[model samples]
Target: MATFAMTRERIFRELVERSNRSGNAIWLARMIASWRVGEGALPDYLGLSPEQFNNLRSHCFSDIALPHLAVSGKTVDYSRMLEKQDLETLLGDFRAPDVAETEWIIAILVAGCLGSDHLWQDLGLWSRSELSGLMSHNFPELAARNNKDMKWKKFLYKQLCEMEGLNLCRAPSCQVCQDYGLCFASEESTSVIDQVERNFNRDA
Candidate 1:
């Protein structure tokens, strides 16, 4: 497994890099990074008071979603995607035994920020192997059965979008927008387009 310094900035940056490559995952990743890089209480990022945050966490962790993750032969449920309890446990599961308490908790909060959305279907926030790698690295026993699943991430993203009142739909004009290419461009193409736009604007 690859090991690196687990600084908040590092984790935030890692998620951001993931976002750059992810189609719809960009929004949640940006929100999570903003929360981490900002100077505020944890609840502030989610618009919850400390007490409410605690309450939510308590409610969530008490009954984890997808308890089948730890058991064998239990079928995974995709229909019940956006339960608050499941969303909470999505973050809670990141608190692996090997992770530092602070980092682990931050990981959970990051997951929370990711929340439920249909965009997740187009832009997978994390793939099955990525999740398996993370779990296997931190909690090997959980990886023994190796059921790599990421549908829960989509559910979590949907929930987050609902909580924030975010509209995840692409605009009808998105396909025709000049800036749409920025989202789909390769690094080199993006750079060339940036230069061209700068020159065009300068001449105008």
Candidate 2:
């Protein structure tokens, strides 16, 4: 049994390494993360056996691909890829009213900023007020519905950092819960949400 497990682990690690080199590791990791492999059978969505899936989950690490994902490049405009519908779908799983909108907005903003080289210059607004105005124009109902008296820029920055942390710690075998380390009740995980909240309050 021990030998079998070891061999499986080796295979999983090799697969991950290959994926990292191919620059598809982020996509692969996201697929694994979405499947929630620890609790049930490996879904047919990935077309891998239960044992193989579990092995990947147990051995996979974000360090292999997260840095590349986080860094900005000229090839693709990541910000433009952050569609509002996608953000809504991603945050739909969250139950908390206060946190959900903020989280979604953050994800959208981070996805936009991360891939833009001249983010500041291109956007043409450094202060929170200017940024908030832009957000209000782009996502009109968001602020009015949330009823949160926070500066949009600071809130956006806080949320983006939290998203980055979440992206960094994401793995199939992560100690953190599926809430992406944002839920307070997840004792097994580190909550980047708390850090973002603290930063927001400080900036406020």
Model 1 per-residue lDDT tens digits across residues 1-204: 012113434645665554323321333343333344321112231433345444433433323211111111112232453454544554455445544322333333343433332222112222233333444455455344333232334434544565678867466654675655444332222221243356568999
Quote each prediction's TM-score.
0.27, 0.23
In the order shown, the candidates' Cα RMSDs to the true structure are: 15.9, 19.8
Scored by lDDT, the top model is: 1
Could you tell me which residue pairs clash in candidate 2?
Answer: 79-112
- Model 2 TM-score is 0.23
User: Model 1, stretches more than 4 Å misplaced?
Assistant: 1-31, 34-95, 102-114, 118-130, 148-204
lDDT by residue (1-204, candidate 2, tens digit) is 344334434544544664533222333333233222121112232323344334443344424322222111222233454544444443343323432123323333433343222222222222234344435444555544324444333334444456556444355633444753332221212222333345558999
lDDT of 2: 0.35
